[model samples]
Target: MEISGIGSFLRNRRFGNYLEASFGVNFASPSKVAVKEEVEKKIQSVAFVEDDGIGAVLISWVRIVVCFVTMMFTTFIWALIMLVLFPWPYQRIRQGNIYGHLTGRLLMWILGNPIKIEGSECADEKVIYICNHASPIDIFLIMWLTPTGTVGVAKKEIIWYPLFGQLYFLANHLRIDRSNPSAAIQSMKEAAHTILKNNLSLIIFPEGTRSKSGRLLPFKKGFVHVALQTRRPIVPVVFTGTHRAWRKGSLHVRPAPLNVKYLPPIRTDDWTADKIEDYVKMVHDVYVKNLPESQRPMH
Candidate 1:
């Protein structure tokens, strides 16, 4: 029998079970020609499946490696250029924001992805940004939206992540130690201070971590605290389809369109810290409604 036919035979549960039974029965009958042929066919079928499985795994690894190397190379060069240019003042900040937008575009290009931005109606400078948690890409998306030097509230653990860690530190991004609420509160206070001192914008992923299901999890009140503390206007940014492109624990970069909608700023002058939960829910709901149904991650 041809090897292809043997593959089908091996895939058949009934046939496979019968063959196994036949092999067991004929094992002691060494002179049975039929038994010898059946045993040989089963071995060949098993070998073919094993070879195909191995080849698939190898190809997957090669593709993942290629994607990682290319992404790293492009990001490294972009970071080097941005660092060397180093825009500081408001005018430079505008230039930097422009650079950020360009960088976002380049990133999408490198990953073979595209991002759509909407609601430019209120792309103001002084605003507090609240977004959903998805991945490290969340920060990049924030940068993509508010290039004008926003102070990002991120985990303290990321400080140890090789090259990106050093760059994040250099950016003077806000670091939060969630394990210690007191430390987290202090971090938020310091972040607010940084915003006022630098006159910079802010981006907070209130969920604290990437949501595996793409659903907006309960948000921490830190962003609300910052908004009320600083008395700054809050801007709600909703991002969709990013999780599909690069999800947590995934290495392969999939090409997908990213949609960003920048809602108007939420004024906090009259809002109290007690009202934070309401604000958080409002933004989370907006995100859920705007997110594409097909792209929402499985729970």
Candidate 2:
């Protein structure tokens, strides 16, 4: 599980503090769940399925091309499937899980990086999965790892992203209007209701945006409120290597080992109004402790 020379390299650029503070949990080396499946010869779809990129430049561009084209095709198919599954809300979301998993799995395979997931994936639990937001790939990777159907709380602007946005809406994820304080609050309540009624795990990135510096950003209180209101356990999912793999402000999807570890679930039964801030820092610390040494939160 050790990555050679990455520590010193990050320190040289002063990004060392970021890795350690990112995840506060100590997850033992759990069984490695390899994301790469057996590569089969498929001549039918060579245009989008080729994995023959050699140099990093070629490899990265290949990923970008394939990702764009494959997403278009898959999203269209998913939209159609979702339309048919519309009568059963839960069934539609469950199918969205499989569709997203397949898309993410394809991206992982094409990126040609090994992914290691630690801890158990929760299924059939109405819990909330909170994690640090580092890169765009983080969300897609989360979709690949989480055990059950997960509804996310994202910014309302995401609804404008063409076909993918339609797919997102069809999946039953909640959206918050970040600019409107009251609307955002109402969105949180709606999210809680969705969790309870649908019996699905919720995924939220409390930082509100991607970390441009790969450091842990200060969390907003919205997700904390949702977890408290819903009385759902909060599972902190920590990720390493994604910020470097694709990084912020970068377009290339370079090959790098992506690691995901789910920390112990925090019980909200004891997290009353008076202790909300304390629990926030506690959960944040668990994420920081589990993060790599260099990425730890600055003192």
Candidate 3:
């Protein structure tokens, strides 16, 4: 029942910043009972209160409203823009999706989560960028970073998510049906061909669904299959502290410090089909090491 050192240990972590309470942080000789009491207090607060007060709740609703309003118009804007340019070369339309990414930037700024992206320069190459999923804001965060000739892979259910989903489809991004294995495999194959034909980079959440508990889930193998089929380098992306910002069912978006690091790319030239299992685990470990202990898998 005594969780003593967690107070000091978690203080060094970002989630501590989210809760904004420090009992034994950097203390010379702190009482064990005090630390235990404060830890329990913080956990209870995290579970019960997502925001500070009515003002904070109002701000959260304002942020949600502004972003959705902007996204609704933004979706129509992209639709009209792409429709007008339909007769032009397809590349022109492909590159025009940056408008949608701008909406993502708006969300990030209003939510007050500043991004610290490492090795983003790697997005320039024709490769597969595989990121861990933890929040719906993940879509917007990546959109803000996604570059020209880079198409993203998302699930088919995205269509139900207000105008955000419609904007995603209008942007010419690929959607995979995870419910049907045959459909998912066919979708990946088509994704591979699209990458090669258009010379585009692919961004996918290999974990498939956001982790409600903030831990890395067992990675699905579709990304590995695409990497092997296309021979594109895989850039492992790890996002920290997003789960606490906007949780699965939470209505309000609590701002938190977020870091997205693009680890060094993994080349697939030497990878063989026979070692698919090894390949999946290898890439999975990359994310585990880059993530905070709070977000890593329990096993």
lDDT of 3 by residue, 1-299 (tens): 22222322322233333223322232233685565465455433433245668898789889988877877776787778766665553443354445634566666766765444556656557889988888878877776666556788888888787766765666677888888878898889998988887787898989888898889999988998898889999988788878877888987788665677788889999888899889999999888888999999998
Q: lDDT tens string, model 1, 112-144?
A: 434445675565567888887675466566655
Rank by lDDT, descending?
A: 3, 2, 1
Misplaced by over 4 Å in model 3 are: 1-51, 87-89
Candidate 3: lDDT over CA atoms?
A: 0.72
Clashing pairs in 3: none
Number of the top-ranking candidate, with TM-score as the measure: 3
Model 2: per-residue lDDT, tens digit, 112-146?
A: 55455556543336688888878878867766555
TM-score of 2: 0.78
Candidate 2 Cα lDDT to native? 0.68
- Model 2, position 213: C-alpha lDDT score: 68
In order, the Cα lDDT scores of the candidates are 0.62, 0.68, 0.72
- Candidate with more favorable, higher lDDT: 2 or 3: 3
When summed lDDT is taken over every stretch of 10 residues in candidate 3, the lowest stretch is 2-11
